[model samples]
Target: MATTEAGIAPRPDQAGLTPLLEVEDLRVEFRTRDGVAKAVNGVSYTLHEGETLAVLGESGSGKSVTAQAIMGILDTPPGFVTGGSVRFRGQDLLALPDDERRAYRGRSIAMIFQDALSALNPVFPVGWQIAEMYRVHEGMSKKDAKNRAIELMEQVHIPAARERAGDYPHQFSGGMRQRIMIAMAIALDPDVLIADEPTTALDVTVQAQIMQLLADLQRERNMGLILITHDLGVVADVADKIEVMYSGRIMEQAPVHDIYASPAHPYTKGLLESIPRVDLKGQELSAIKGLPPNLTNIPAGCEFRPRCPYARDICKEQRPALAEVVPGRFSACHFAQEVLDGDIEPAQQ
Candidate 1:
């Protein structure tokens, strides 16, 4: 079995230079009529100051679920954090009181949901919605909050910020709406920012702009950023580290360039191959063979064995541990050495 690295992420409670956020042995489950679906299983990683960690995975691979859990937004009826802890600046968030957690939601940590239109209130003007953050958190007067909202709008490069501040959610284009979401998320300049698929539906140019804007904001504030998305193509230049998750567990973790150059896990290898390339135009785009497994009934042992081309008897009989494969990389594949040795084909995603 894979051994966890004592896996203690730094928190603020500790002395100096502690990590901004650390998640260790975290598990989340959802109850349904059928059974409990394990959404996150023993997932762990650390984010330092001004660092960006990009989580890449399939739609149901627990990317967003884990983020929701961190933000304290998961609905408890169906969802529960079964194990481990989420520590921010050394404070155990899971142990915080409900009211205290609510207080931390936007001021210390913030999230930009997948949909902006739904995230923003249709009845209220954009500025009112943004100002609400200040009104509620800092007790800013309405006029003062609205002026701050316009400043945020202008900072995000929204056109005619003062005028558009009065516009409703329906008035802005998709890119502009997304900017508005970013503006609100950063209003308090939270120490950590979690953007769940910030670019959902927009033209390629707009997507580039949004990502660039986020990068600039991170740089300007020196904030730790957690970018949760399925788009492997977008994170290459932005993220300092990459964590590839599958079937509620982390399959691979490494620095961004190392992961792109040579992934130690087969699933990460497959995901990399699946990226569309201009040079590979006219060739069929690669895809992982099957749909992600039903979490309620994840396969025994290695969850990815059935889909992996290099699966062996050992793979089927025993689950691989997410052990250190190299100095700075970790992979949950028994044959990680074989993969690094070029036994697996690169174009096999």
Candidate 2:
């Protein structure tokens, strides 16, 4: 198996500095009426400070689940963390006691959910919610917390922050509510920020604003950012590195420029081809054929072989481990070399 200097899977930590967050062989599952749905399987990655790693995959590819697992928010009874080690700042988060994990949730590591309206409580004033984060983490007095909350709102460019701070969730626009969510996320200056489709409910204009806001905040704080989004365009400007996931596994991972210029996995190529481009105007956009496989009964070898145009018998018989075909680029495919040689292309949909 390909290994980093740490004797683990190939990760960003191999070079030198320690990663802010390291997810090793992380797996999650859900017990549904049908069967056990393996959402994430052996997914691993490392996030360094001052870097944005975008996790790209269609819905249900376990991108969000992996983030939730790191944040200790996966609902039980149905969903459960099967196996993994979420190491943050040299400590294994999964192994930490509940109290310790709770302390880490919003203080050391924070998450911004996709829906700001639902994520923010409707009953309480938005300011109260933001203040509660500070109160809980820092044990600040109510007055001090409220003051800090207004400062945070101002920091996120929420207009009339002092006045709007007392307003409930419904009083704010979608974009403004998302800004409030961001303010709450950065209130504690967490070392890591996991944004799971942070711009999902907003317009293109608002999305751009939010992405820029996140980039600015990361730069100011030098925080590690994990942006989970299916939209390739969303990460183009923000991400330093990108991980392309499919059917509960990472198909390809590399620096953002490398993945866009020369994707070495069929799944990555398919995703890029699926993006609507100005150059492809009037032409039907390309899309990968077939739905993602059911994780309960995933294909024996290559999970993407059924939809992969370049698949061969070997791809069906033996699972391909992710390998570094080029410096700092990894792809899990039997024909990775062929992909690098530009011999394969996305199947014209």
Candidate 3:
């Protein structure tokens, strides 16, 4: 599991710009008193250097769980990754010992959590918290670590970073706190960054700022970024590709422009329709009917069948494999082509 001093390399078979990370047939489940809930089922994707992959879905669609599994941060008592592999630079992470895998965190891969307040240690000074990474991981002197923390604070655009380094987590505003979180995550210059709802409660202007900062940092570091969120509009400009998930499965995956222009799955189409559009001003916003299926007891065939307007007997009788509907686009729906062409009206509710 030891990587070279030059760091990780691409898979042997891959030619040209190789992917930085790959997840194949990943499955995770949570064992609860009610039942075993399948959280992530056969989730797979590739992330290349400097690429932005956005995972979009409603809440409970397993976006966060998949990220957690990849990071090796899932709580094991109730949750476990039951199948598949997560490869970083062609190395299978699941096969690594726990200590070896832990070393990769922060140094090779880092995460920006949704809530900065909860993620940060409130009792400690922000600088001390950030400096801890360098001091603990790199064995730097106290003075050097503190100085590095201030440098990172400034890098993230916090004004008066030297002075603010002594400030506690509660002293900074929400946006500034989030920037500190980002600063801490990138301290080791990780090759891959997974941001789980980085702009959850921020205003539109601040949301744009956070996203821009992430993009700028990604470009500067040439890092592969995975942005997980429920809002499609937030990722419209930043994401290179999209994976729309439902009931723990990716219902559709396509280039960002393609998904916006023509979604191939009914579930994806419904998600697009649900977004508020300027042209539809004053008109009631469309919404997907019913709700996501309960993971413990998903429907027999298509998990989305109950809420899908395009559902038919075939949909109820058999599960559709996620297959390429076009050259690059993939969808998990039996009537993918018809749906993409808008050939059939949604069954009347």
Best prediction by TM-score: 3
- TM for every model, in the order presented, reads 0.92, 0.94, 0.94
Collision count for each candidate, in order = 5, 0, 0
The 0-to-1 C-alpha lDDT of every candidate, in the order given, reads 0.88, 0.89, 0.89
* Model 1 per-residue lDDT tens digits across residues 102-122: 888888889997789898999
Q: Which portions of model 1 show Cα errors greater than 4 Å?
A: 1-16, 278-286, 344-349
Candidate 2 yields a Cα-based lDDT of: 0.89
Query: How far out, in Å, is residue 8 in model 2?
Result: 28
Q: What is the lDDT of residue 301 in candidate 3?
A: 91
Where does the lowest 10-residue lDDT sum fall in candidate 2?
1-10
Stretches > 4 Å off in candidate 3: 1-15
lDDT of 2 by residue, 162-208 (tens): 99999999999999999999999999889899999999889999898
In the order shown, what is each candidate's alpha-carbon RMSD? 5.4, 4.7, 3.5
Q: Which stretch of 10 consecutive residues in model 3 shows the poorest summed lDDT? A: 4-13
